[model samples]
Target: MLALPASADEARRSGYDFMSRATRAMQDEDAANTGMLWVKDGEALWNGKAGGANRACADCHGDAVASMKGVATRYPAFDARMRRPVSLEQRINLCRTEKQKATPLAHEGPDLLALSAYIGMQSRGMPIAIVMDENTKPFLEAGRETFNRRQGQLNLSCAQCHEDNWGRKLAGNPITQAHPTGYPLYRLEWQGVGSLQRRLRNCLVGTRTQAYAYGAPEFVDLELFLMWRANGMTLETPAVRP
Candidate 1:
């Protein structure tokens, strides 16, 4: 949360009043609150029984609160077990297919977002701690290179705007560091909700890289770089995003 203005404090105004205004400006209209609904859907998806093999995610993992606690904070991590860097999304799909015997959900599909939002919320308030273990270091390095690589017609890298010029308006929207502390964020512009990967894909199209297929290796690398960049920040899953 942004700090309440210091000047407002000295002027005998209630802090709550200032907070309300700050939050209100960010939450105008329908886009303000769609994340919770998505998260709720995720809860059901996690446990709802389905798929060709007649199996559900719950068949393998059980409860998300108990089983998924602290899982998100370490996500976009290098997975020695899998010999790949994994995002929370990837791990979720791993269990769904191998253990639960089901097809993986589409990248930005409701099932994916719901599970993402739910697991993300579990790590709320915990600092981001994605590890670059021996197996993952190359992936992390690749992701950083990809992040700095300029592609598409604009020939612009993510750093040009998000890293070097954060807080500046692009057309109209304010630029942030493209941090991943908030995943499964409710986006006002979409008037719905989505994952950090969804947002990154949007940027890719804008910058003109032939956007990667959902769950592609490059996307995983990008996720790792973002998680590492936001290390020590708390998860704000299902958070509001512009």
Candidate 2:
């Protein structure tokens, strides 16, 4: 398991007030967790042979329950081969292309999301534990800058709505603290599960700013920073959201 911080306060925040009590309850109920469907599909994918090598993830990783537990909490990790930070999705794709000799799944595709949800589910209740070493520090700083920089026609930064005016209403919706613990979330608006990058893109569009493309370096950096900001928060992958 990933190591927890000495103090939970390292990046602690209030409970997820953005969600209603009923919605929160639904998230905790396995029967109601629509994201579990994806997890099930991912389980199948993990064991099934694929690609030219005809290898399965199980061939190398063995049981996901043991190997993947708490793995999501430490993601957007620094990869020496890539020489940069890579999100869980990026790492999954890397494995598909390089190790499995399979074509990489498209970003936000159903298969990719399913696999991501499966891996992430293994880390449920774990705290975010992104490493902040010298190699990752620069990206973290860049992410912080991006979070603070005012952009778009609205001329607002991420902190304005989330940090400064949390618990307030924005366009009839509650402004959340922008925590990323509950990701690959099943959103009512989209009527489907989506990655954090999808939500971030939506926020950018809401701010009337041109959103970054999927798999962009900026998005990965921002993800690393957000994970840092939410360090110590429990993993709530495949969470339900309004």
TM-score for candidate 2 = 0.94
| Model 2 alpha-carbon drift over 4 Å, by segment | 1-15
Local distance difference test scores for all models = 0.75, 0.86
Give the alpha carbon lDDT tens digit for every residue of 1-242 in model 2.
Answer: 23436664554453355678888787889888788888898899999888888999999999999999999999899999899999999999899898889999999999999999999999988988888888988988898899988999888899888878877888878887788987788887898889999999998998998899999999999998899878778889878888
TM-scores, all candidates, are: 0.83, 0.94
In model 2, residue pairs whose N, Cα or C atoms come closer than 3 Å (at least 3 residues apart or on different chains), thus clashing, are: none
Q: Which 10 consecutive residues of model 1 have the lowest summed lDDT?
A: 11-20
- On a 0 to 100 scale, what is the lDDT of residue 36 in model 2? 84
* Model 1 clashing residue pairs (backbone): 42-114
Clashes of 2: 0
lDDT of 1 by residue, 43-64 (tens): 8887788766677667767777
